[model samples]
Target: MRKARLGVFKFTSCDGCQLSLLNLEEELLAVVDLFDVAYFREATDKPLRGTFDLALVEGSVSTERQKEEILNIRDRARYLIAMGACATSGGLQALRNWASLSAYKARVYPSPENVHALSTSTPVSDHVYVDYELWGCPVTRNALSEVLVSFILEKKPALRGYSVCMECKRHGIPCLLVSQGAPCLGPVTRAGCEALCPALGKPCYGCFGPKDDANVESLLSRFRLMGLRSEECRALLDKMNTYAYRKVQGENRS
Candidate 1:
């Protein structure tokens, strides 16, 4: 029997999600045996050609080149999964959309005109259809494995729709917001990665993106009640998953 062909593509990102796959180490070998890696520039030098059974796309679409590349990849791949916060929700770079990109470019570069980029860094779904999405700033290895196995078996991936608060409760970890006065996004963020950050005594920065039914307004109110400034709340939501947060906010108002 022929194995499924898998392609891993990247655009503009820290490559953390891709690194998560490499961190799999031994499990990666097992995954390799199950799928033929048609394209993975980070892992191999071999050129990628033709269509693939599954394409794991990382990073946000920030340029015309990325837009075209994503469309082409989507057309060729049987399953297109947006991997990581960048591909699923525009990543931290999407914060630029909240401000003037031209001004930002002028301040950072001597020749702003030379910088060829889109006004907004957008998620892959904005450009083309995405079969599925694996969230997180740099997705967890377990989630990656689950998604791969589920896709191969033609079964829906087992991802949670609840908030990270559930995981915190499951692990018997103290509520950082209540105890330490740390602003935690856990209540509104998706449940995954086993509540890693909160368990480490750090507030969640919402690396897993928003849950299916995130209450952004209530969360914002909670943050404000905890003495977090409005600007800080705005900045917090404007991070990696700004688009997703904005979408929720828009929905709340409408």
Candidate 2:
């Protein structure tokens, strides 16, 4: 059987998600055997040519050029998978969405006029249809493996929709929020990291983004009960997955 043609593309991102794929190391050999790897600038010098069976896109649409490229990529690929927080929910750079882009540019750049940046950083889904989303600051190898296997099997990936707290329970890790009064987002954050930070006795920073059934208000109430001020609660939610948190809140409100 002809291997599925794979294309990996990058935009405004830290390339951490792509690194996770490469970090697969021993597992990468199996991925190579399954996919043709038609185009991947990070892994190979091969220039993009024909249509792809699958396109794994990382990063957000933070510029006009990227917006156009994503649209074209949508047309070229039979299936498009947005990888990481950047591609799925606009990454840390999306923090600029709530601020003055011009002011930020003037402060950061010597030649502000030379910088061609959009006022907002947004996910790929905002620009075009995304068949699937793999959420993380840098998606975990297990999630990548699930996606690859699902693609080969021509089935939907079995990503967990539960919160990270479940993973904590499964791993038999103590709840930092409950036991030590630490401000943890595991209650609202998605599973997949396997309670990594909590297992190490650290608070979850919500790198996996919000779970589908997240109760932001309830979590905020719990935080307040734990002696966190209103500002502290807001700050916690307004981190790496800010856009996603806001979106979920908006959906709940509407």
Clashes of each: 1, 0
Show the lowest summed lDDT stretch of 10 residues, model 1: 234-243
Q: Candidate 2, residues 61-177: lDDT per residue as tens digits?
A: 899899889999999999999999999999888889889999999999999999998999999999888999999889999999999999888889999889999999998998899
What residue runs in model 1 are displaced by over 4 Å at the alpha carbon? none
Candidate 1 per-residue lDDT over residues 166-246, each given as its tens digit: 999999999998898888999889988799999999998898889988989998998899888999998787788888999
Q: Clashes in model 2: which pairs?
A: none
Cα RMSDs of all predictions?
Answer: 1.1, 1.1
| TM-scores of the candidates in the order shown | 0.97, 0.97
Candidate 1 versus the native: TM-score?
0.97
Worst 10 residues of 2 by lDDT: 233-242
